[model samples]
Target chain A: MTRKILRNVGVPILSFVLLLLVWQWVVVGFHVASYIAPRPRQAFLAVTQNWSALWPLILGTIRETVYGFFVGAALGLGLGVIMAKVPVLQRIVYPVLVLSQAVPIIALAAPLVLILGFSVTPKVVIVAWIVFFPVTVNVLDGLTHVDKDLLNLARVYGASRWRTFIHIEIPATATPLFSGLKIGATYAVTGAIIGELAASDGASLALYQEHANANLNTAAVYGTTMVMTAIGITWFLLVVGVEVFATPWQRRTVARRWRRR
Target chain B: MTLLELRDVAKTFGDTIALSPTSLAIAEGSFVAIVGPSGCGKSTMFNVIAGLLTPDGGDVLVKGERVNGTTGHVGYMLQKDLLVPWRTVEDNITMAKRLTGRVSAADREEARAVARQYGLGDFLRHYPTALSGGMRQRVAFMRTLVTHQTLLLLDEPFGALDAQTRLEMQQWLLQVWRDTGRTVLFITHDVDESIFLSDRVIVMSPRPGRVVADFANPLPRPRTVDTLIEPAFIDLKTKVMRLLHREDA
Candidate 1:
């Protein structure tokens, strides 16, 4: 077991280290200027040197992203279930949602910041907006496209509408719902940063990036970008972890299906 | 007592008639099988009886109570096992009671006992995806039986199984039917299966389906695979085949 886990963990780490070494070698060997394309060592140095200043920015961005993720996820799941169960509501609301999706949430961020007074609310709301569509669409697809046989069984067995929704529809849609949540988690970070970019008084990663670029500290800008990527990847992994814990049955089901195939 | 009775049940979709007005009766504890070709409206009849769809004409009576355009009176197993993949065997088995808000400790205990009786005690916590096809059908059967409803409707329940598994399921179904004494209305296209498992076999005509013939299976009780070779079984098979062939011609 230990050896297997080592092989699983070791290969990715080794490959990543090799790529970084190659990147470092290429930058140093070619004498690339830092201002144009920051060297790997310089980017790493920028992060270390700016740690004290960047710490608060990272925390602020993370707070907004986390809040946005939960709010957006909750709204998405609730709306998805409602729209799936109530077709009349779906008919009234679906087209509007589709239209809203076409209008980029980033474009509305500045207006939202202006209206909401540049607080975390705009960022969180923007993040929620960004995430809400995919989550809702995935959930809708999963619920609507369920195995017809299962629905027939529910009908024949006297399952009430609510009962059917809880037992049949909800469980069936869980994997897809989690898939939406994972996508939403990654977008939450981007949404928060964009909102911060629109207007922010306090420290945020977006503010740092803007300041870094203004000072022509390209390495610092790269460092800020790296931090944001880290945050997004971390949040995504958290969502995946929760999904694994929540639906252990899905793994078993998939494995069983493969075995049969 | 007549557990279920259909009177002049006729259904149409748009301009296409699925079933012609027809009447049938099932006693309180007898096993009846319906045999027909593809598109003969055997499924339509089951849907009407199970209350998934209401017939355009006539009434569906369950225990003499007119139940039309409604569902959930009888236990129904579809052409496939239709077990919810996410739910455990025990949970699936107890779902009928759960849906009606009638599930209790006793009901759950009974479900467990029934699972054990059906040789699924070891798999009570296992999901449908983990079970073999035959095991999954057994789970479906336990689920249907646990409803404790006197009337059961099985729509080609073993039609998806291999020949060997299908034979075993037929024997298992017979034992279960005999033990429970529940009224069963089963649908199938297999003449041998219909004769082996049913007390009476009702054959329907094509398209705007109507009952062409109803034969009381003359095979003796406590039948087994050996019974398949019996002269009486062959004679009944020939008779049913002749009717089905005549309709095809």
Candidate 2:
């Protein structure tokens, strides 16, 4: 099992290096002008050289993303648990939650920016909007979709509702909750970027983005995008690592599912 | 003394009645097993007895007092070892005592002593996910024990185990039951299990269910799994099997 996990970690990293190697080759081979798409190495170099200069913008975006992620996740998970337990809440608010996720948050960005002004508020709101539905829906499904026999067993022990939540409901729903958090983390980065793009008139990166687009500083754009993707991937992998550590119960289930693949 | 009585207990899902006004009494200290073919009301009876559902017609009594919903006297274990994956075996067992009442240091020591006596002494700190299937079941059993409830309702507790594990568990359970001396009402479709464990076995008919047969196990006390091959065990098994075939007929 340790070998399997080590193999999984090593193989993916090597494969990613191979992929980038090919990417660098293809970009250089086709004489793809820097104006069109920057070389992978150049983009890396640009990001590295500008790393210190980029800190304030990166930190600013991370702050927006994190604030949004927490607010959204807490609300979503809380409402999800409520809806799962209470039919009236399910009837009233579930459809609204469904609708809330339907309208692409990208479509909502400009107006959100206008209303919330060119401030951190719009960005945080956008991130929260992006992170909410998946956490709520997945968690609610996990909490309510418990096995019938297990429910009966709890009842027989005369487990209090609170006790059942701690012992059965929450634990049973762990896989889905972890999945929700992982997905929420990925969207958090995008949500923050969207907030920046939409409300960037006075922001540090905003000024750079306006000038960069005209000069076709595509390397810079790709650098920002690559950095954001790295952040998102880091967030996702952190969640995945936590899931593996906390829910050893899922290791077998995940292995079995992976085996079928 | 009658500890629990079900009077006219009937549960229906839409037009289909699962339990039909079934009435039964469980005496204190009696280990009774309810047995029947699949789709019978054995599980329904256990649920009613456990107070998980509201019977359309009847009332459930715990210790001769009418109880409408889930109560504390009954400790239930099910087919699956529902130990929380994140909890240590000791944590799982200790959960039943957490919020109840203040205990002397001696009582906590006694709880640990009991767990150690039950073959789980070494595994207190280990998480449920670390244990094997059988060990997990033992932890589940120990958890039920921590509550110190008088009545135990086991719903096919060993049904999910392999046949070998299943037989071993039946014998192990007998020892535990004899040790604890809790009133046990176990539900299963396994005729042999019903015969092997209980002083009396109640057999029920299939859906739209009713108890069609009840047999008393005349086996000797301190029974071993080896006794299952004895003539008296064969005779008891034959009787339950006959009632089971009657359900098919």
Candidate 3:
């Protein structure tokens, strides 16, 4: 277990430290001005010194992301299941859903801010919207294409539609659904930041980023970037944790062997 | 008494006929094997009997009542084991009872006992991925039999196994059939398997399949591997093969 942890947790930390060293050298050696590009230490100091101002913005972005992720994932799964079960609904709505993806999220953000009037609602909606398509597509694919022989066996045994859905459809769709969730998890944070950038009543991380960039406070920009990366990593890990527990049967033996070593 | 009777049952998919007025009856506690070449609608016949397909012409009467276009009458095992990979062997075996609200304490006990008898006691907690193809089929058979359905439609359940596993499973199946006394309608292309496991062998002709011949086995009970070398077994095997191969000619 210790060996496994060293490989997993230790290696990443080592690589990250090496990257910071390189970054520090590159900034110092090139004699880059602080206003254009800051050293790692400067960025760290910017985060620590400006903690009070950055904290609330960070907290706000996290909230919007979490709320948007749940709502979007729920809606995506529900609609995807509906589409899989009823082909007519899929036929009517599928083209429209595809078309919506073509119109960029940025284009919608301005109109959404105008309509919703600079509330958290717009931020949450934007996050949810960005994550929806992948989740829906994955879930629909999983449900429709379950193993044919297994389905026939269920039919012959007189399994009720509900039972078949529960036993066969749900489990079969889990891996694909989790794939969608992972993709959505990454997008949720970006969506919230975009909404905040478009229009916000007060300070959010995106607004902080805009101010830092406008003032050429390069360290503060990097600090905001670091905070967003943290949020994205945490969200992704949370989804992965759920996937690990939800589908124990799908665990890889190769991974288990590595853990054992 | 006849447990299952098909009366002039026919089926067509669009302009193509799948089964052509096929009729047969299965007696209670009897083992029957149906042998035919591929595309002879052998599967379609089993599907109709299992109530997976509606016959275009006549009736499928189970215990003298017509059942058409409905399922769940017989325990059906397909070519693949079809055990849900996510479920353990025990869960897969007892799934039917759970689905139908028959999962009483007694039924659970019966399922455990059956699993034990089938040599799956040690692996009850293991998922299907942990098992061999033969072992998976054993679980599938147990799953089918544990439903306590007296009629079984096994659509080439052993067709996927290796030669050695298939032979062992054939003997295991015979023992189970002897013990349970369930009426089995088995489908196979192998003439040897048909004659070895069946009391009666039914043959079907080419596409839009129809029953071409039906003959009772003259072989004795408690059959062994030695039976394969016996002249009587060879005679029966040859007869069924001739009937099947003639359709090709």
Candidate 4:
């Protein structure tokens, strides 16, 4: 078990340390100006020194991201199921959905804030807008493309529409649903930051980063960026953990395939 | 007792005739095998009886009730095990019950009992991916059996197995059929398999498929692999082969 944990956790940490060393070497050797690009240690120190001041802003951004992600995920799943059930709705809505993704979320963020006011609501709306497309598209694909044999099996046994949906459709679509959720998780962080940058009355990570940039506090800016990245990574891992819990059978299948190799 | 009757049932897809006006009567608790070449409308016939496809003409009667274009009258298995990869063996077995209505504790107990009775007790919690091909097929069979339907339509259930496993599965299937006393209509192109497992062998002609000949097996019950070489089995096989070839000519 310890060996397994080392393989999973140790390798990544070792690689991260190597990366930090490289960053340090590049900064010191080039005699880079600290104001232009802070050393990794400087960035780390900046965040730790101002941890008390920055903690609330980080928490606020996280809260907005969580709210937006859940809202978007729920809306995407519900819409995908609806579209799958009714092909006519899919025909009308799918093109619009794709086209909507073409319009940049950044373009909509300012107006969304202007209309919704400088509250968490606008930020959540922006995150939700960014997160919904992948979730809906993936879920719809999963639902529409369920194995025909399984569907026939359900029908042969006289499963009702609702029962079939519960038993066959849901299980079949779960993997794809998780795929969308993972993508949405990363996008959700970006959405929160965009919304915060557009308008936020309270302090947020984006606002903090903007202030640090204006003051030429490069170390603080780098520190804030690192925090944002950490949040994105944490959300992604959380989704992956949920996926593993939900789909135990998939893990076994994957293990079997690996053993075969 | 006639459990299922198909009278002058015909089907067409666009301009192509898939099945002719074919008629068949399946007795209660009889094991019947249908052998035919590819595209011989065996699947179309199975679909019609399973109520997945409505016959263009005539009627399909189950227990004296005309059931056409309606489903849920019989248990059906396919060449592929079609076991849901995500479900455990026990869950897969009880899937039919879960689908049709609520699965009570009694239903789960019965499923466990069936699995245990069939030597699958150890695999109740195991997913389909963990099972061997033969075991997966057994699970598929158990799933169909748990549906509690009197008639089962198995379309080449062992077609995907290796030769050795297929032989073992054939015997296993025969034992299960005898133990359950359920009427089984098995579809396969393997003439030897049709003679070995079934009480009756049905030979079907090429597309626009019609029953060329229906021969009752003279072999006794609890037949073994050695029965494949029995004179009666050979004679019946030869006759079925002749009819199939005659249709080709």
- TM-score per candidate, chains pooled: 0.94, 0.88, 0.95, 0.96
Predicted structure 3: lDDT: 0.88
DockQ of 2: 0.32
True contacts kept of 1: 0.64
The candidate that achieves the highest lDDT relative to the unseen native structure: 4
Off by over 4 Å in 2: A1-9, A244-261, B12-14, B98-112
Q: Which window of ten consecutive residues has the lowest lDDT sum in model 3 chain A? A: A252-261
Those runs of model 1 whose alpha carbons end farther than 4 Å from true positions after fitting are: A1-15, A253-261
Q: By DockQ, who's the top model here? A: 4
Across A19-39, the per-residue lDDT of candidate 3 in tens digits comes to 889989989999988887799
Model 3's chain B yields a TM-score of 0.97
DockQ of each: 0.52, 0.32, 0.44, 0.56
DockQ: the better of candidates 2 and 4: 4
Off by over 4 Å in 4: A253-261
Residue B35 accuracy (lDDT) in model 4: 96
* Residue-by-residue lDDT tens digits, candidate 2, A1-261: 888978989898999899888988988899888888888888787778888888787788778878998888898799889999898989999989889888887789888977888888998898899898899989998987888766666666566777777667888888899889888998898888877877776655545555667888888777777788887888778778889877765554222222210
Q: Estimate, for each residue in A1-261, the C-alpha lDDT of model 1 and write its tens digit.
A: 788768967987899789779978887899988887688778989999989988988998999899989888888898888898899999998899888778877788778867998788998888888888889999988999989878878888878888888788888899899999998988888998888988688767898899989999999998888899889989998998898776767666433323210
For candidate 1, the TM-score is 0.94
lDDT of each: 0.87, 0.79, 0.88, 0.90
TM-score of chain B of 2: 0.93
**Which has the greatest TM-score?**
4
